[model samples]
Target: MLAVLLVTSCTSSSASGEQGDDAKPRSTSSARPAPPRKPVALTIAPGDRAAGVEPGAPVTIAAVDGKVTQVLVVNEAGQPVAGVLSPDATTWQTTEPLGFGKTYTATATGRGTDGKDATVTSVFSTAAPRVKADLSMNPLDGQVVGVGQPLAFYFDAPVANKAAAQQAIQVHSEPAAEGAFYWYSDKEVHWRPKEYWAAGTRITINASIYGRDFGNGVYGNDSRTAVVTVGDAVVANADGATHQMTVTVNGAVVRTIPISMGKPGHETPVGTYVVMSEHTDYTMDSSTYGVPADAANGYRTTVAVASRMSNSGIFYHSAPWSVGDQGHRNVSHGCINMTTENARWLQSISNKGDVIVVQNSGGPVLESWDGLGDWQVPWDQWAAGGKK
Candidate 1:
């Protein structure tokens, strides 16, 4: 019997174990898809709750394998710190300095390649210096000075790292002059050109000392700028042999004055001098320099006009008492004595930084530490920085 065709035709089951042909196969592997890529680590300098951090230390936020998206840094006073973010948003840096002895807060946010966010925060305090060095500069800002003037700086606290101090003080001049810095002491420094400054030169000094380490726990207190203008090239060359002073202006001889310089025992120093100051109706007291007014060589003389040339008691003032010896021989004590009229005329034409050269005086050379004796040292020696 066809036996009802006994056709138990066996059709294969679907790969999905379903009866329909449209059924899809199922995955048998148990492995899940690889996890999303991890984000880059974010770092902030002066880590959280840091203390005694240098104000000038790089207050920065950086990331690797990620990008910085935003940043905020503020002082305790609610003042925001100035900062700049990298163009690629990978780093943030502080542009302005932080205040000392104050707590600061910083927040930075970043995003990783996995599309994840990273946030970081820091609370830090800047170091408080044991001592702050006060800075003083000359020539005064916007003042006019003569060509021989050197830009001088004085620090109240001694600087152990003098080279760093010297680097912080920069001098810029128009028609650039070859110059160098000479340190007279731990707290004093002066900058001068190899030759006298050219008339009409403009000079600017930048003292970026704030946050600088001067060593010995000393720190700079502030930053400053000074602008000075150089005026006429007024020079006075005094000859102890000729007993005359030839005054020149801009390389032209302007006047010839009969003068009596220091006596044999107290000869004027033979070197260059820069005019320091001018006085009107001032009294010259010998006791100021330890010479008693009652002493034989000491006298309290008052003058109408006087131009102080040296710190150790020297001036070309109205010494009418020595007018009789003018143009004749050395008679005064370590000063160029001149007539009152001539002295007044000299005062009228003089300004700070003017040059006064004493030649053939037979006295010892001027000490570099004396007054403004920056020109006393040869250029080669002066350019050697100093014994710092």
Candidate 2:
């Protein structure tokens, strides 16, 4: 009877401790927190954002969540430049040649693959500068121009590569004069023969640039060549002492005119000057060239056929005031004063680039010194600045 009572008590304790089926802890489902969403931010610098950066140029990109995992650069036409990646992957660089004045774009993409953040996209630009340039002749087949003219090439942009440009530029003539280019500046270039080109000679210039790069993704497009037929060389001699000038064409004296030169102290230059311009009835004001117009310090007159020799105020024009001294004596400022008929004749004989030599003068040579700019520098000195 005691054992049966103990067994009944143990069974009751087990029943109370064991939870009922309905009282079991409810297993409610809670949604797992969605993965953190990616933030959107893409920032690039060097606002002219593109590709084809200069050698050793710096490129930087900014993004949120450090999502910038990749960057790409394409050319102006949306072509990729080769080897545009650094080993560290911090920057994008180009090992190949980038053109000049070209356009490109850099793209950056970031992904939240770590599953802790979001993705991002960024775009930037970098440009290479036009350092070395080549100026070749257009019309590879070749054409012809005036006999007196050289193969003239006007650069579309300033060139930093003087030697390359010079090397790429070639001149072919029936009889080569061993031509050389004289760079007036990054903007202007002039080529000439060791001497004046042979009259009636055919000259050609070839500017070959197909795969060549000028920097800034500005690749030289098609090759070009300019052809010209050389004309008779015109040479004029203006003697200040004799108060006379002799004009020659193709080694023949075509015209001679009596003229008045500058006075003893204010003489004209004695050297070779090119006929830069021509005009009829040009005003002569001392004030324009820093000469006062007072009777004691100025010269005021209206001359004809104002052919400019230099940037100075000197010219070969009609001088009615010095008619008495014309062809006989040298008296006046630094100018060649002639009669209206002689001045007109000079116009007929003179051509652009025609030589005008003034001899036996006491004053300075009217060599484009005042406003001539870089052209005033001697040829040898001018070409010395070129980078090989």
Candidate 3:
């Protein structure tokens, strides 16, 4: 019995040794902890909150050491918006449009291989359209005007409330001259002292047209400024009876040209006009003025060196065909008929602000076509024409 017990014990010992020898080697006794979590960073570009920006702006967020798991933008209500996560889990992005004129918040989260997690957040606001008026003055703020020059302002949108817009506009100068703003149209406004600006006087304009609704849905952009130096005044007088138009620089006669007045029916107007525009070889026709051509009332077309006399169809234009009647006869419809060479001469000497006076003619006045001239209406009157 003792021998049998000894054999069983030996068999048990041998089995235990075989199992120990077949086992794999163990380099580490326990599993390693995951890498430390990465730090998350969120960045917002264009820090301005008042600038008008459209939706779907691009945004990005990233983690330094770990993988980015998620990134999202939310409104005040904390709703999830469009966002993205990088393949390496180290970055996130929002690729969708955002709401305008609203505040938004962004959040980013990341996880590292070390079984650690990280998170970050940021806030920003979008631009919203506000109510108010802004005016932008041209020729630069605090500029000087040369002699016989006028101050002008341009509006981006057509104004229905010309009176309101004009009322908000003001001008200041060293001599404190009386100036008036005339609405040429919904988009253009010009200010002129009763006469030309005083020489060496500093002039300024204050315009507040922002956020104020012009007709339709348009609004003013912002306030603007302008300053200029005034120089010597120049004038030009044209007499239909004498068939002579004289140009005076600083009240001195510099140039004189023999001119022909308009014909009986289509007479040139009598008025004070500035040198509005000058061109060579301008086309003239009664059709442009809405006058139909027929046997009695209609007329054929004519071309000349067209110097625009008024917003109306009148021009100190070239009429080579009327040269024979220049000094002795009124042969043109309403233009100050001149030779091409003479018109070219005038064009060389004329400028935008020079004045022209047409006298002794049975025709419309400057104000007759002032509507076409559109630049003469007062600012108060212009504001009254707005929709609101």
Number of the top candidate by lDDT? 1
Off by over 4 Å in 2: 1-160, 184-188, 205-229, 292-296, 365-388
lDDT per prediction? 0.87, 0.60, 0.62
**Model 3 Cα lDDT, one tens digit per residue, 1-388:** 1121211121122555554534544333444564444444434342324244333345567666566776667888888777666676656666665664667777666666555667666677654544333444544654433444566566655667677667656778888886666655666776666656555667766664544345344445554655555545556788888888887777788778888988898777777766556676555766766776654665765555676756556777777787888888787767688888888776665555556777887767668225233234444653343233
TM-score winner between candidates 2 and 3: 2
Per-residue C-alpha lDDT of model 2 across residues 12-40, encoded as one tens digit per residue: 22466874445533344445555555553
TM-score of each: 0.80, 0.55, 0.53
TM-score of 3: 0.53
lDDT tens readout by residue for model 1, 1-388? 1112222233436566556655445433344455556696788998998987767666899988789998889999888988998989888999998887889999999999778998999998887889999899888899999999988899999999988788788899998999999888899988999999999999999998887778888888888898899999999999999999999999999999999998988899989999999888879988877789999988788888789898988888888887888988999878888888988898888789999999988888988778998898888888987656
- TM-score of model number 2: 0.55
Error of 3 at 61 (Å): 34
| C-alpha RMSD for every candidate | 13.1, 23.0, 20.5
